[model samples]
Target: MRIAFLLALLAGGVYYTYVAFIDLNFLTRTGRLGPGFFPRSVGVMIVLLTIWALVDALKEGREAATNAGLWRDVAMLMVLAIIYAVALRVFGGFVATVLYLAVTLSVLNRGRPLQNALLSILVPVAVYLLFDRVLNASMPPGLIDILPI
Candidate 1:
């Protein structure tokens, strides 16, 4: 499973690297810093991290056993992320992210309502402020737009 996780990460890293290369045009149109600069940097980082993860997995395979169900956790996280993506466009970032965090934490930590609620609300609000205010990025308004906040 660890090997599988490493392989998946490596594959994703490679795919993103390819995408970053293709997206270079978007970055080159502007000044020295292009739109692809950040994404390419991220791709490079992912590639390095995936390589490191693969090495660690190989070393651990030879050493003591490690049964953390890393793949299962990853799968669950992916599903939650997909849910959040779909919900974000339809339900808005706040609602989608809250639901995603709530569901993911509940599944992972066995449904602690107080903890889940806190995480769900706090994380989305923080992200909203960061992206909307700090980064000046646009996000879907969703149903919440009806209510004046």
Candidate 2:
């Protein structure tokens, strides 16, 4: 199952990298980094890391059986991912991210409300500044605008 998962990721990364290179320019007219840069870089890294993990898994002996708790955690994350996708469509980028991070962190990183709260707000703000201000790219727009920021 682990090997299959890694293989799937490898295939996705290859396809992503192919599209990044073929459909998008690496540099703009003035030679600044283009929109493809981040996706291309991420795709490449994903490919490399997946390959490395696959190799390691192949070398290791039989996998230990997963417990019920492990399965529960995985299910929780899967549900959370679906919720996050819906939240993205409903609340847009910034607010959805903030909400997702808050809930996810509270659940996963228990007993650290202060840390989770700080991270919930800070990471999205940083990403917003980086994408909106520095990269001049727009975040996903939602159905209704709530926060002006």
Candidate 3:
């Protein structure tokens, strides 16, 4: 099971790396890297780590499957990610990010609603400020683009 999961992750990482290389536009070079820079870097890292993890898990034998828990949380998280991708364009980065962050935090920190709520609000806002103000990177401002941003 662990091997299977690792293989699945490796496949996903490879697909994303392919997408990164192909889809994103290269900004005319200035001081900063192109739009694909971060995604390409992350894709490579994901592929490398997934490969390492798969190799390590295979070497450790099949005992991992017996010790591992059910796939409920994993399934739920995957569902959430799918929803987030759909919501991202319609709701824009801030709203989509906040919603995704809140839900993920709620799921991961089940007993701490207060922490989840606070982080849901704080994290996205901080990220927005850092990226938009400091880094000068634009986020998808979808729908009511004028207000929150």
Candidate 4:
């Protein structure tokens, strides 16, 4: 099952990388960064990491699948990611990221509320600053427009 999951991730990453490379330009007309820049980078990283994980899983063989708790954790994280993606549409980048990180950290990093809270707020702020201020790129706006961030 672990191998299967890794294989699926590798396949998805490959497809994402293919689309990023084929459908999007790496640079704008003026030679500045384009829309495809981040996606292409991310897609490449995903493909590489997934391939590494798949290789590791194949080496582990049947022994890795014996841990039901590990599978549960993987499933939970996947579900959280899906929720975060949906939340990005509804709450936009900053608020959705804050909420998603808070909930996800609470579940995955139990007994560390202080760390979780700090990360939940700080990471999103940093990302917002990186994209909106430093990069001069637009963040995804929410449908509801709750925070005015």
Which model scores highest in TM-score? 4
Instruction: List model 3 lDDT by residue over 1-149, tens digit each.
Output: 67888889999999999998999744536746788888899999999999998889878886634323447777788999999887787788888899899989988899999999999999989999999989999877676453566
List candidate 1 stretches off by more than 4 Å.
1-68, 143-149
Candidate 4 residue runs with Cα over 4 Å from true position: 1-65
Better of 1 and 2 by TM-score: 2
Pairs that clash in candidate 3 = none
By summed lDDT, which 10 consecutive residues of candidate 3 come out lowest?
A: 62-71
> Which model is ahead, 1 or 4, in terms of TM-score?
4
Q: Scored by CA lDDT, what does every candidate get? A: 0.79, 0.92, 0.85, 0.92
Model 4 lDDT per residue over 1-149, tens place? 67778888889999999999999999999999998999999999999988888788777767523578987999999999999999999999999999999999999999999999999999999999999999999888899899997
Q: Compared with the true structure, what per-residue lDDT tens digits does model 2 show for residues 20-135?
A: 99998889999999989998999899999999999999999568887989999999999999998999888898999999999999999999999999999999999999999999
Model 4 CA lDDT for position 26: 95
The candidate with the higher TM-score, 2 or 3, is: 2
The alpha-carbon lDDT assigned to residue 10 of candidate 2 equals: 94
Task: Summing lDDT over every window of 10 consecutive residues in candidate 1, give the lowest-scoring window.
Answer: 140-149
For every model shown, what is its TM-score relative to the native structure?
Answer: 0.48, 0.56, 0.53, 0.58
Worst 10 residues of 4 by lDDT: 58-67
The deviation in Å at residue 8 for candidate 4 is 9.7
